[model samples]
Each structure stands twice: as C-alpha cells, then as structure tokens.
Target chain A: MPAIEVEGLTVRYGDLVAVDRLDLRAEAGRILALLGPNGAGKTSTVETLEGYRRRAGGKVAVLGLDPARDHAALTRRVGVMLQRGGVYPGMGPAEALSLWAAFYPRPLDPAGLLERVGLSAVTRTPWRRLSGGEQQRLSLALALVGRPEVVFLDEPTAGVDVKGRQVIRSVIAELRDEGVCVVLTTHQLEEVERLADRVVIVDRGRVVADGTPAELVTRGAGRSIRFGAPAGIDVAGLAARLGAPVNEVDPGEYEVGAAASPATVAALTAWLAERDLPLADLRAGRERLEDVFLRLTATGGAGDGGQR
Target chain B: MSSSPAASARQPGATPPSAARQLTRALAAQTAAEARLTLRRGESVLLTLAIPVGLLVFFSVVHVLPLPAGVRRPVQFLAPGILALAVMSTAMVSLGIATGFERQYLVLKRLGSTPLGRPTLLAAKTLAVLAVEVLQVAVLSGVALALGWRPGGDPAAALGAVLLATAAFSGIGLTMAGTLRAEVTLAAANGLYLILLLVGGMVFPLSHLPGALADVARALPSAALSGALHASLTGGGPGGGVESWAVLAGWAVLAPVVAAFTFRWE
Candidate 1:
C-alpha cells in the first residue's frame, strides 16, 4: 500500500477553503514535491496529512490509518518538520535531540543524528545561540531522530545557504534510498527539479498540474530555435526564406519555433551559410520547465504568444 | 514486527499496572520538561518567585492598612496570607499567563501532538506547578521562620493546607489560560492576583473588613487557601471551616473540567 493517500481532501478555515478536493498518493521510497506559491495551501495540506489539522471533508489515510483518528500511532511512524516550529531557548541541540528521540519507541542515535544533520560541532550550543542555518539543521535532525518511515518537510531549506541546502538535499536523497517516503514542500523550483520524483503544482487551493518534471515541461507544446543573426542579414528575409515565423527579441537576437529541433538547427545553419552570414549563436530546445510553470500559472497569457 | 504481548495488552483498556506506571512516568517527564523551560526563562522566574517575595516584603513592612483588636502584630497576621498569595502568584497568575502565551505560540499544540494525550498534558502541567509550589513553600517557610512567626499547630497540617491551596488555584489558573486570549489572560491574572492579595485576605485578615468585601473574600479561592492555612497554623480545627474546603473542592473540580472542554490547541 502507498504510505499516504489523500482522496478528495478538503480543508476550510471558516469561509476560505485552504485545500479543495485534493487527491494524492505517495509510495514508500519516492520524493513527491508539493510546489505552490504562498497562500496556495501547501502548508495546510501537509499539516492535514500529518494529523496536525483536521480535514473538513474527504478521507486521508496515512500509512494505512486515518491521520486524524490515529494520530498517536501515525506520529510514531511519520516525522514532521513543523513550519516555523521553535525549540526551547535554553536547551542545547544535543539535549533537545535526545529529549525528542526519547519520546519515540525506536529512535536513531542522537550522536549519529546530529552528525548526519551537520550539527555535531555545535551540539552543546544552546538553541538561542545557534545561527539560522544551524537551527534549520537541528530541526532536520529532530525530524529524522525518530527514524520515521515517512517524513513531511515544509520549506525545509527556507533559510539555509547553498551548502546547507545541498546537505539537506543529500539527506533527503539518503532517506529516499533507505525506503523512507519524503513529502517536501518548497518554493525553490531548482530544488524540486533536482530532488522530486513527482511534482504536484497547487494553485488557489487546487492541484492545477501533477506529473514528472519533464512531463510537465512538454505539456505546453513544441520547441523553439533561438540564435543571434548577423548584423546586416535580413532577419525578416531569413524568416520568410526558412518559411518560419521570426521576431527580433533584441537588436540582433531572433527566435522561431519548429516541430523538430534538429531540423530547425540544420535549416537555420544552412540558411546562414547560403547567405554567407555568420550565425553567432544558435540553439534549439523544448520549453523550459519554468516557462511552462509561468504559462500554466499566469492569468493573462496563452502558449508563448504564438512563437513570438 | 509485532509488539510484545504485554505491550499489546497495554493499549487503552487492558492489563498491566506497569503500563499505568509508564504512562505516569511519561507524564512526569513532560512535566519536568515544561518546568525546566519555565525556570530557564528569566521573566518567568522573576514573575513566579521574585514578584511574590517582593510583594510579601512590601505589604508586611508597610502599615498602610488599618488593623483590628486582638490581631496584634500585623506581620504575624500578614505572614500566612502572604504565603497563600505566593501560591496564587506562582500557581495561578504565572502559570495561567504562561499557558496562555504557550497556546498562542503553538508550543502546547506541539506537545499535544505527541504520544501524550490532552488530559496527560494538563496533568503534567498541574504536576509541574506543584513542583514549583514546593520550592515556593520552602523559600516562604524559611523566610517566615526567620521573621519570628511561629506555627501554633502541627506543621504537617500547614503543609497539607498549602498543597491543597496550590491544587485549587492551579486548576483555576489553567482554565483561564486555556480559554482566554493571552493579552486578556495576562491582564486578568495579574489584576486578580493583586485584588486577592489585598481583599481576598491573602495579606490582610478577612475579619478586618466590613460586611460586603468580607463576604466576597470568603468565596475567593485565595481566601479559602489563606484562611484554611491560617486556621491550621493557629491550631484551629478544620471542622468549623469546611466551607473553605468546599469552596476549594468546587473550583478544583469545575475549573479543570471546563478547561478540558474549552481549551484550543492552536
């Protein structure tokens, strides 16, 4: 069975529906990235799945048990890095980890947990004394200390630097390798691209799109050919000669679309050769994931403005 | 892997006194952790211990209020009342105010999500308040003994009186903290502490007041606590003033039940 199954889930805060008819399933060893902008209910969805908040409608089964009904049991098997959770100011990182680990039936070694989160050196430092990155690492250590079967991380790399982000990414990968399901919510698209096995893009409290990264990228349409033209070459003539629509993006840059990327590149190169014009730069590729994301999310536009 | 038979049987309603003991131990651990956090906070320490001690010293030495006949030595009469006030200040005011803030911060919510249940969390917080009470009593008792105040009866009864008082006030405190906004709870708790210290007979004898305030004093939790303790310290029989005990019992039962019903975890 899947580790988490959320079917027709709806959560409302008063009149505002935070999560609307959401359907999702995650298996044992894959990372599912819940990507959304602020106020899109990503945090609310995760909180409901973790049994921290009650769902107003539909069903949520986590690890084969209802999260809201079987909270204590679910807590034993799942680890949560609560959004903006604060530890006691006076407690040292080691003491806090040890204390939290003691609450679980079977927990990872405190020392090893610290070391894995890169917090071993400052284990003795009090929580208030730790830097922002260190605190984030400590939070990660606490979430992993229970040796949980599934982990829910919300904005886990919010304040971390590049190195710290990589450390968290690697730890998440390691968790996946060990057959631990990870549900990560993040605004950083690059991190999602690198780490997520599947993507769930939420907008205005609904899942607008859900698939693999590459799959979502090509959902928009065909590829485009972008190149820098020679100064005096008839950029408009080249467009007419190649029988392809063209537009100058800048003084000497132009772009056009093609059904086949290789054919487009060859046609552009030969067209330049016939005209004895130097093609300063040329490339053809599918629509970028970011481009697809913007198009799908933006309110005012449709499909790259018809290749212009 | 399956759980041990004993562990499986220990589920909610089954066998094993050991399971109950383990639950109690878990509760105690949670309580200790909370107390440790409270003690580490400088402001909480000041509010819990320092403010009461300061108030006690200030009211005992100052002769601002009038005294009655046969109540010679205002210090002696004020001493028991101040002791009760200390309990109220820590167990009721400080505890209530802190819990309100904790609820606002979602600290209590995090704790509630643990293997520990809501009832266990309340029990643990009450137990932690008791631990702080013991320390408060030791300090106040030491200070009182040094100040030439002598107990007229068995010391054990006095200790029992203080413990009962702590329980009664803690219940009221937790209830208010759980139900009210942090800002409102803070103001109400501190305001009530001052009102009780003066009019509820914590620093002044209720007998010294005229009809109206005296009647109100008799019903206040601080009055029951201070009067009961005063009666015990002065060798008075517990039989005549079962009213105080009854008042305390009413609060101890009602406040916790109400708190449990109304408490908001987030």
Candidate 2:
C-alpha cells in the first residue's frame, strides 16, 4: 500500500475553496515534489495531509490511517517541517532538536542530527539569532530527528545557501534511500529537478500536471530547437520552408517546435544559408521542467492530462 | 553514521517503541522545555515571581490598609491574599499571555502536528505552571515568615486551596490564551490581574467594600481563592467557606471545558 493516499480531497475556507478535488499518492522509498505558485493551494493540500488543516470533503490517509481522524497515530509515523515558526526564539538549536527528538520513541541523537544538518557550528546559537538558511536547516533537522517513516517538508530550501542546500539535498536523498516516503513542496524548480523522483504540479486548486520530470518536460511540450539570430527575420519564410510552427520568442532568440527532426534541421540550415541569415547558436533538447510548469500553470485549467 | 541506532531503527523488521512509552517521554520532554522557557523569560519572571514577592514584602512591612476587627497584624492578614494573587498571576496572566504568543508564532501549531497529542500538550503546560508556582509559593512563604507571619490553619487545607486556585486560574488563562490574539490576551490578562488585585480582596478586605461590589467580589474566583486561603491559613479550619470552595470548583470545571472547546492552535 502507498504510504500516503488522497482521493477527491477538497479544502475550503468559507467561500474560498483553497484546494479543489485533488487526488495524490506517494509510496515508500520515493520522493514526490508538489510544485506550485504562491496561493495555488500547495500549502492547503500539504497541511491537510499532515492533519494540521481539516478537509472540507474527501479522503486523506497516511500510512493507511485517516490523517484527520487518526492524527495521534499518524503523527508518529510522519514528520513535518512547517514553513515557519516552530522553534522557540530563545532556545538554541541543540535544545530545540533534543526536545523534538524526545517526542519520538527511537529518535536520532540530537548532536549527531545537528552535525548531519551542518548546524554543529551554530548549535548553541538561539533560533532568533540564526540566519534564515541556518534556521531552515535546523527545522529540517527537527523533522528528521523523529525517525519518521514518512516526511513532509514545505519550502525546505527557500532561503538556504549553496552549502546548506547541499546538506538538505543530501539528507533528503538519504531519507529516500532508507525506504522512507518523502513528500515536499517547493518553488525551486532546480531543486525539484535534482531531488524529486516524481513531480506533481498544482495550479489554482487543482493538479495540472503529474509525472516524472522527464515525462513532464518531454510530454508537456515536445522537443524544440532554440537558436539566436538577427531580429525581425522572416519567420514566415522559415515556417513555409520548414512546414512547422516557428516563432521568435525574443528579439534575437527564436524557437522551432514540432520540426526538431534531422531533416528539418538540414532544411532549416539550407534555408538560412540560402537567405544568408547567420545562426549564432543552435541547440536541440526537450523542454525544461521550468518551461513546462510555467506553461501549464499560466494556462489555468489543466492544459494536458499528464496525470499518472 | 551508518552504525547509529537511528539508521538501524529505520530498517524493516525493527521494533517500533510502544505508544505508551512515546507518550510518557514526550510529556516529560515538553514539560521540561516549557518550564525552562517560562523561567528564562525576564518578563515572565518579573510578573510571576518578582511582583508577587515584592507585594508580599511591601504589604507586610507597611500597614497601608485598615485591617478587619479581629486581625492582629497586617502581615498575617496579607500573606494568604498575596499567595492567592501569586497563583492568579502565574497560572492565569503569565500562562495566558505566553500561550497566546506561542500560538501567534505558530509554535503550538507545529507541536500540535506532532505525536504529542493536544491533551498531552495541555497536561505538559499545566505541569509547567505548577512547577513555577512551586517556586513562587516557596519564595513568598519564606518572605512572609521572615516578616513574622504565622499560619494557624491545617496545612492540608492551604495545600488544597493552592491546588484549586491553580486549576481555576490556569483554566481561565488557557481559555483566554487559546481564543484571543496575543496582544489582546496580553491586555486582557493584565487588566484582569489588576482588577483582581484590588477588588478581589487581595490587599484590601472585601468587607470594607460597598455591599454590591463585595457580593460581586465574593463570586469571583480570585476572591474565592483568597477567602479560601485566608480561612485555611488564619482561621485554623478547613472551612474557607463552602460557598468560596464551591465557586472555585465551578470555575475549575467550567473554564477548562470552555477553553478546550474554543482553543485554536494557530
């Protein structure tokens, strides 16, 4: 059975429907990244799964128990790192981690967890005095201290510096390798690309696209050829010759889609040579995750049913 | 790092600790942390400990208020009242305001999502309040004794009064903390503390007040606490007035129920 299952889940704040009917699942030993813009209901959906917010309608289960009804039992198996404000401002990171560790039956050693999160240097510094990146790392440590079977992290690397981000990335990778189920929400597309095994993109209270990163980029928008050329080039001439949709995205950068084949490439080179239009650079690749996300979310309603 | 028990504990077939053991450890850890936080805050110390002790000393040395007909000295008369005031401040005002800010900061929201259940969290907070009150009582009693105050009542009766007052005040405090904004709770708690300090018959006798206000004071939990403590400490009997005990008992039951129903973590 999956570690977490949400079917037809809906959450509303009075007249405002924060999360519309949504279905999601995560199995043990995999990392599922929930990506969305601000106010797209990513927090509402995650909070519902964590049992912090009540669901207006539908089912949400963590480790086979209803999150809302079985919160006391479910919390033991799942750990959560909220976006902000969990640690006491005056308490040092060491103290905070030790206290949180004690909440679990077989918790990680506080000192070791602190060192693992790269917070050993600031172990004695009060939470209020720590930098934002340090605070995020400490929060992550608190979540991992519980030896949770499943973990949910919201914006885990929001303000983290490069080194701190690496520490968090490695820790999350370790959690996945240990056969633990990991679910996280982040706006950092690069982080998602690096860490997430599966990506679920939610927009305006609904899941717009859900699949592996490669599947999303490849399927959402097919392969394209991008190159830089002189502005105001006769893109109509190129389109007539190539017999495919081509547009100049910027003043100098142009993109050719649906005609990225070798024959099209040769034809385009021949066409450019015939017209003496210099191709400053040329690259052929599938769409990046960022491009796919922007297109899917910017279009509002589920554009393509890439659900898996 | 791989040899760490935390790593081994995650392996399949490893036995998870029993639920009862987890609960017990969580409760203890939370209580200790809560107490440490309360003690570390300068404002909490000033309000809960300093102000009460200062009042006890000042009132004991200076005969500022007129005493009742049979009271021999002001120290003897004011000691028990100050004790009640200390209980009110620590359990109600201090706990209420601190909890309000904790909620505002989402500290409670975070902890509420953990394996430590709400009931257990409440129990840990109550335990922390009691722990602070223990120190408050010890320091205040020592000061009172230094100023020539003697207790004439059953020790058990005074102990019972302290426990009841803690319950009544903590319940009311938690109700305020759980329902209102941090700033609002701060203002409301301090306002109630001051009102009770003067009209609840802590420094002044309720008999000295006009008939209508005195009756109102008699019904309040603060006055009930002071009256019960007075009867136990000075009157040398378990009869701190059945009515006062009844009022306190009613508050002790009702306030917690109301708080539990209305409390929000964030």
Cα RMSD, model 1: 5.8
The 10-residue segment of model 2 chain B with minimum total lDDT is B1-10
Kindly report which residue stretches of model 2 are placed more than 4 angstroms away from their true locations once superposed: A221-224, A230-237, A273-285, A299-308, B1-18, B236-240
**Number of the top lDDT candidate:** 2
**Each model's RMSD to truth, in Å?**
5.8, 2.7
Model 2, residue pairs in steric clash: none
Taken over the whole model, the C-alpha lDDT of each candidate is 0.75, 0.86
* C-alpha lDDT of candidate 1 relative to the true structure: 0.75
Candidate 2 lDDT, B29-123, residue by residue in tens? 99999999999989889998899888888877787887766787888888888989999998999899989988988889888777788889889
| Per-residue accuracy of model 1 over B139-196 as CA lDDT, tens digit each | 8777766666676765686676667767777767777887889899989988888788
Compose the digit string of candidate 2's lDDT tens values, residues A1-308. Answer: 99989998899999999898999999899999999889989999999988888999988889999888888888777889989878888889999998988887777788888877888899989899999889999888888887888999999988878988998898898888888899999989999999899999998888888888888877743368887888999999888988887899999888887646788889888988998999898866667888888887785346453454
Local lDDT at B101 for model 1:
81
Which sections of candidate 1 miss by over 4 Å? Answer: A221-235, A248-254, A272-285, A300-308, B1-25, B55-68, B154-164, B179-184, B207-211, B237-240
Candidate DockQ scores, in order: 0.21, 0.53
Q: For candidate 1, give the docking quality class from DockQ.
A: incorrect
